[model samples]
Target chain A: MSLAAFLTPESHSTCRPVGASVLGQRLESPADIADITRRVWQDSMNVLQAPHIYSGVEMALWDLLGKRYEEPVYRLLGYDKAFAKQPYVVVPFAAVPEQTFERMRHIRQAGYRAVKTGWSGFGHGNIASDLSQLAAAREGLGADARLFIDAARIWGCDVVAAKRYCPLFDQFSIEWVEEPFDPTALNAYADFAAHHGRMRLAAGENIHSIQQAQQLLNIAGIGVIQIDCGRVGGIGAAKEIAQYADLRCARYINHTYTSHLALSASLQAYAGLERQDLCEYPMDPTSLSWSICREHLLVGGDGEVTIPNAPGLGITISLDDLQRYVVDLEIRIGRTTLYRTPSIR
Target chain B: MSLAAFLTPESHSTCRPVGASVLGQRLESPADIADITRRVWQDSMNVLQAPHIYSGVEMALWDLLGKRYEEPVYRLLGYDKAFAKQPYVVVPFAAVPEQTFERMRHIRQAGYRAVKTGWSGFGHGNIASDLSQLAAAREGLGADARLFIDAARIWGCDVVAAKRYCPLFDQFSIEWVEEPFDPTALNAYADFAAHHGRMRLAAGENIHSIQQAQQLLNIAGIGVIQIDCGRVGGIGAAKEIAQYADLRCARYINHTYTSHLALSASLQAYAGLERQDLCEYPMDPTSLSWSICREHLLVGGDGEVTIPNAPGLGITISLDDLQRYVVDLEIRIGRTTLYRTPSIR
Candidate 1:
């Protein structure tokens, strides 16, 4: 279980953040570098021993290891390169209608089989208007593509949101509706599930810990349990919960914690995991989506990513890349000027 | 229910994060930030209907407000600050033997009623030496003063840990031993707890979500339940579990996510709570232990902090103070050179 053996044989390499010119520190030891990643992951947001608490690092270290490992991240996670395509989503929150459609078209062309969209707000003025948008969005996705509408629990259109949403779920043939109304709304969601049990609900990554996962599972028995590994702190706990999901007949989906390494580690946790569907490959357009980790995650022609073949994680760090773009870690901007401290050392 | 009315008419300073510092953009309505806070608090975390995922930020805001409001956060739920003095422990870690004792004397000088120490390792040359250290540390603490000892539960010390550590607890007048092992080792911790129930069994904040809390509560009630507001993702969920503890006749303590504002907020919640003892206040020297919401949490002369008396937590964020320290929201620190990103603009 020690990632040591797998990590032992790697030449050090540097990590470059996307759009940045300078190199980050070149990692010397994969295991030691991995420890740094783990600590950072633990310190942010979620601080509980909840369902899971995971830590990961190695943008600089992972890069060196990737080259030494001679394979990508997916292959390391036990994913076969043949099925190297990844399941993904397109968040159309701030996009115009045409832009969203265009984005979806590009994603489709780029080999993604499914796309999720329409999450900013349900601004239909009424439930009917919201429903119409869903109908149209589904039509745009067409029969060949899978479409997910992220309403973010805007199901408060009174009777429409509560009673009518599920039927609409069936109408649009939605893959699964997420956080239709937050955790408290589980009973309402359950009510929907009880009646149109076929309308499949997807949620849980928003949950910060395992105990919450257990409560959510007990309360709703969700169709697709989307687990956010980072929010819980790390991959180990997610592994346990994913196993529980497999045993319980519910599908587990990796909840995104905003980085490819976080996403990749979760993909590994899902290895041999039953009832698991997709590990959200957050391919946002921001340089952030590209530079946040040590390596750029890719999907193969088969619509899945081959898990990293190297030990620990076959992450490739590019210090030069990250330094090229980063000016500070904690930045503050006022209307007149931005206050930033460069890494003087 | 709202916090605005509690503030003096002249109180209107707002602390804006430098990156988003256009002050008036949010002050459109009559000074009613608490109105929004209340709504977000109510709708998102608190009263979030069961089976919902709780986020920590929402609760932290509430905790911050409670301090600002000069009222026990729990007082909002209609409970009073029950204790006359806020009894808490200063964590002692990362210190050599002599230095740790020297620091303990200073903690005593600061008027703290109790102190807790972290675990180093347990065994020596493998086993015997480590246990000897534990005994020496316990003896040292007792030699200087009567205080509580928190076993750092570094794991793998067999039943000897249980037997040796269990009796040492009584030798030091240690009220309750913390985690001491993995979460699943409920039996092991319980075994130790059973060995000393009259002293009061303490645990939780590590137990994520309500489901795990339920498991802990079921495994024979511990005297004190420490819940971490950050880990649980907000005050609403923390309260739900705290209230559940009230229902079950167990005491609850806040797990430390100790920002000055958060501490005040916890005091407020404790005011509203029925069953709960002191919060795990981190006395270690970190900026986090003091202030973060652009406010200072002043402890009352009585030792117990008087919960905020103003609307929300009565915290007035100082934009100037925030600007002084925050460089970037996220920085990538590698083993060698840490990257600095430009200030958020």
Candidate 2:
């Protein structure tokens, strides 16, 4: 799952990389990173998986460039300094309303100014059950805290089905309804956006390319553009979308639900954009995800999280933890070894 | 590289597929095929590679369905009969105009009523060179032959560069200009289409899903929508695009270059549309590609190709050739064998 790209001053190259896990290639400029992204995209022609695989390689490229230049990734991305982002406690909805209420109450008690509950059978059931869940979440989070609903695309382009929850969204004071339809369903998104009440439509997390992100902004009529650096061809593409969204006068936010390394990578893209203040924070990550990085971007007393000023992604990887969680893999074609697990060290 | 899906009446299943190579699952209806496609898409979240891998599976599903019902795949798709398609002889531009002329002449002498020359340094060079190539192609093909130019997307998104060839396109009576830019560069396509004269803009060979194909027709403003059945989620998706194009008053054509099996699969989608007669025929495919299928869709005396009236794809796979070309592959994670090459038999 973790992929790294190493760079050296000599042996300049274009397409030769070690394997999917490690990009043993040279890094020259930002264009080289874009070239690599395009090459990977063209090679596989899988917008989603190619970006997912190369996102790590892209992060590694930026990390290498940042380290070589003795600057943080944000600074390398033309940012003056990293700004603090208001972290929203992201939690999946529980099976029942009471559980959801308790989960929201705990998040509110933890001093989070915003909370997002998504994708644990939240919108899959009847409207009454969804209403109950939304009511519980709002009541538990208190009237002042911002509440966000992540439908997780349960409606799947059913504008009418999604519209039924508009009353719940408005009644609960939901800031935005995220991904109520398939990410690529632009027409459905536009239709829903036109009819939805006060709550704004938000999407773009599933987008892998900048063209697609631009399409979402241009055609989907969504207010907020959420990008996951780990999935959207890494930080460069995310930054491009961020700039495009800024020009379009749309809100931008990072979507991270994995390790702190990923969180830092996601944050660095729009780290200097003061207006895009909100960021997703993984409240209940798996043990492996939590242990992958040595340092975490912790929420401050002001309920804001800031990226590290250190070089690269500004997060340290735990070699021991990586080794502990590594799954030894090998792929062979005939007698030739196509790929083998690279040494963690 | 080949993937297969097997269905049995007794073992009713949803998601349990054997591996990337074979699907040991049941498919009850067209909805099941769609369900599998959606599941594969959701699993990888890849529009391209996921469809690519699933395409063979999809073809297998259709093949299975057609076999079980004693009908051709087109019939299963609700087509009354497979219509004849004008087979266009597809060739690559030689290094020089003389060589291009010779190739086109040979295709014309062989009784191909249409010719398409692409890639191999056609539009990548100066406009004069491209014009000479186009002129040579037209001169060699004679005045009656339908001439097409496949730019092979060498210009990327440079509308100005592509615009420089409009005069040549019009002067040569080129039927269409194929893929002057990247497949996803819809805006560039639209911009180029706006200014380009006479010759229609053609694209969509790289499209993986029906959504993208629809986007090309709806936004790119292209007149011809070309789909590769092997890549665009197989026959069903191709049919959907074909039907969509027909409704939009745009011409639909199949883009196949690999094997006759693929050509047959591609042809089935639009076999009922008589007006959409053009079909890509590989004039010089790789030996292995030619050897994969026992029965080839050869151009008839009328200079047209037609699908077989037999059940399923009608083109039989050469099992011996498959065994001959098979490369034993194995993917192991720790001590568990995740995948091994399935038997050709």
Candidate 3:
């Protein structure tokens, strides 16, 4: 679902928030957005899993609001200035230990001081394989660099299974272990956090509401709250969580894996928080993700990136790329066309 | 989304669980259900809000499983026998106090011992109107009958607003005040539960997962835990919560306002718990809802309802009604057809 919120066509300040999931209901006009969002909130039993449609619509609304006010989204969100963040190169674990080492080495060579390797059978394999991968990642990053391991919820609720890798994580000096258990497995998270040595639990990328994030911080004992703006009901919700995390004395970070547009939206939430400096940057994005924005927030000499100072989300959406990648779609109920993809002007 | 799960077409035990929300993705075969459910869990930030699709799918799977085993769903769920539940007539508040009185009187005359009036501007109006309605309902039902007030979440975290009617609730001997605040407003629920009078807090119909139901029982201080199997990831999740509620000594009830098919599915969760007897029976269902099931679970002279002893959900789906109501739906991407409404044979 690609939503462009605008006051008028002549204003020419269209805001696009591309939602990956399709909405269950049809929106006749912009007036329906709030009502639909409220219905979604009231009807959905789990706000965290059902907030994608509302999230995208909310992001677009914020973008439009920013453009109307002629200020950056961060400024509109009450931040006087956007803070610079240390960009961590995010990649998946390679097929083998040597490949994982090479990937980490390449990231280090590319001036990224922090790197995260996740998914791709990381925790699913044998203990020896995991140890080799961890050893390779640490050796390749060369000691001083920050290394984050994302287990991607491989262990579910099994504390014993997750604890097996804790010694290896401690040996590798991992900054944090991300999503070792399911998000709703509060007991498991708390238990794991209590037993783990040195490494802190980091999660909340899947959080859609403020309450879930607070639960993770308060009950799950996570040291880091990673929020994705596009997934967490847009910037407003993410900002709320960031503020809550600050109140609870926890680190807040943005989780971005898609376009630079998403990256900017994610950053605007906690862009003013200088202390929570790390930002997850997609180092090897798919072509579709890369095509969404014309200009990217590139890493600088200091190995840090800042959100654009210009108005709205401060990134221009590439119409040409969107058109090239656009799939012509239509949804028909009986004889009536409920939805048809609008032509890119 | 209507799903029919079966091991084989020749088995003649097609189980249908009609989902209120459309699925975001297309399922190629039965094998995709588990994978899609997992994706929905992982990708959705709010599982409670996003589990509708999975819930319906899950119900269908359980129905099929029960049919294969030649036993009632409750028995398959590990219950030795299904217990009879006290049926309560569920209706919206009338337009005026007199109408409310008449409605309650009518329900009483029809032999229902318990009645619940909710929504339709119940708590939205001034305190005087609420009191008048409450008085009228109580007087019409007489002194012996149980009265449940469904606030329909009109207060929205306003403890003061909800508290204004507490004295009236106690005076009328109201059994429970349902959803006085927003489902996610844990603080408000806890606050209101702490200060409220005789009427206990009842909630959990909006719960989509076991964790959420448990949270309400353990943290929110709700005495009555209502589970809608059609919404809370099907019978499995509802049964889990019922057991959890039993362990915590919370009153477990079904929140059904749809077809008899849904009512049966809802009943199956807590059908084994004899002590938790109240079952919500839709007294004012829409025509479409009424037409969905061939056989209805009518309240007996004993003022109680029981699940069918037959295999599966027991109630036969009205194919004629489904065909009559089925809207022709088609989704197309480019030249390829992703989905079209399956013909009801």
Candidate 4:
């Protein structure tokens, strides 16, 4: 077989390229990927005991497997059907409620299908002010648009408080209330679900793996199982969770308030899922998603973006862009450091 | 209202004596109990931000309410009918398999009707080793006895691992498999349940409050919702969870690997439910349950204990035994320290 190439710019040149030769095994199938990844994980655990350290390696393996199969990673993972992604833009909280309302309008005008706002001012302070902001956002986005409220885990609403306050958002036509309480408080989540049966409760962005996703979705009344590929291990794990969510009849919303790389990865995974109805597209103006990649994977006028078809993540990394934004850089070969930028003094 | 009495010996005198006067209210009804507990909980959260700190106070409130009503706390909690207690004794993991076998025999001979063992010898070991111990216990206890396996969250088996290992226990007539993975691994638990469709999965003892229990019970495939009153806030919270579990058609098994006081407390909560089928009675010889209370809440030959009918928590507090067993004591009066034991010389 011809050499499978991956470019590494001068800054991160020491990082090893992944291929059959580098892995010391022929990357012929998913079984081979599993065998190598498991061994790599075992090796890491025996030495460093850091399971998270292997995620990047595992994701890269999936990319290579995609290239090897001459297909998108989703299709390689057996998702043959096409998915039309209807993206939702998150309207991050502004100190001024009116400014937040304006941003919600901008999000709708950006051709986004849906919008999400936060609960910064909801649980405490002037709840009426928060309610008004939600109402304004709903009004700005128009009646046909979907609106979601993300408490972002800062809203310290207990089940009782959540029950008392969540329904107040219903008048604005809130699609779902996300993370109204401590995520660990699953029962509290259930109570909120029970009390606000009319409104949907969504979670799982902070959830760590496919297994945790399974548990969260198994929660009888949970309506949405939010998936962020970066937080939930990697694309491999996300696909597994998305499949499980489909089986449970829960909505799979790719949580994409992450970097361009992660959002692209999530898009690839979402492309193959049957329930790819809506996804998070960090459409917030201040987000770094647009600037990080050489080529923009922009959300079009209809609120959808084409899944990248290029081999291995389908986006070119701009070395200048990485250097401009990165706080520090280091390159290592085994235990020896090949290079590292000097600390900014 | 007249002053109510409580006996707090010198050793545990640091523990507050609960009364209507101390609570600064007439503890005349369950409504009053609720009012006080909520206030106490709010005050603690405001000052200390630790909700767990108020559980003892909340439990004491239940005791006060029970005393005022001249009934068991369960009856005060709205369980109006008779319930016959059927108990299961937990046979915690023994060092040796044969020793475990002997302990199981002892448990049956001790008049317990059902038995529970641990996962130390199961999951990873040759399946037969765990199976033999279970079979030996089953044979000793007779075919009619119910057997359970408590992994105690040590098995570390994922849903895949659980699916592979759980079915092997079916021949031994295992009642349920308890927490084969980290309790936080809810997805793993769900997956295990999904795979082992024939076997029942039980959990919730480590759960801290009624909300969590409700969440765990709300999880699909969990057949048994185990409640340890001490861990689950108080008898008040346990009653709430038991009620929810009942509605979900899940079995309510009181978890009692605790002191006699907590065991008695759990029994009170257990005795009120229509599903008062099995409560855990730690039958290990080394357990303090055998000698803590002045009068033993003895298990009959048929493996049951009558609910303590005395006012409050029905069992007599053995002062001498408490003093002997207690490692240290402290008492506080509002912000002032009333007493604290001297450090060991």
Q: How close is candidate 2 to the true structure, as a TM-score?
A: 0.92
User: Could you give candidate 3's per-residue lDDT for residues B269-308 as a string of tens digits?
Assistant: 8888888878998864456777878888887777789789
TM-score leader: 2
- Candidate 4 structure quality by residue, lDDT tens digits, A1-345: 001011111211112222221246667777776676544432221111122334455667777877766777767777675476777777656777677778777777767768888755655646777777777787778899988888755444456666656656678778888877655566566667777762388987755556557656655357788876764657777878887777767888888765666666787766776556677876433545566677656776666776776666676666666656653333333344433455333
Q: For candidate 2 chain B, which ten residues in a row score worst on lDDT?
A: B3-12
Model 4 lDDT tens row, B99-148: 77677777777667687877555566566676666666777777778888
Q: What is the DockQ of each candidate?
A: 0.16, 0.45, 0.41, 0.04
Would you list the C-alpha lDDT of every candidate in the order shown? 0.51, 0.77, 0.74, 0.62
How high is the DockQ of candidate 3?
Answer: 0.41
Worst-scoring 10-residue span by lDDT in model 2 chain A: A2-11
Higher-lDDT candidate among 2 and 3? 2
TM-score of chain B of each: 0.67, 0.90, 0.86, 0.80
State, as a TM-score between 0 and 1, how close model 4 is to the true structure: 0.55
How should the candidates be ordered by lDDT, best one leading? 2, 3, 4, 1
Give the Å error, residue A158, model 2: 2.1
A227: Cα error in model 1, Å? 5.6
Candidate 2 to native Cα RMSD, angstroms:
4.5
TM-score of chain A of 4: 0.81
DockQ leader: 2
Clashing pairs in 4: A215-B186, A215-B187, B14-B331
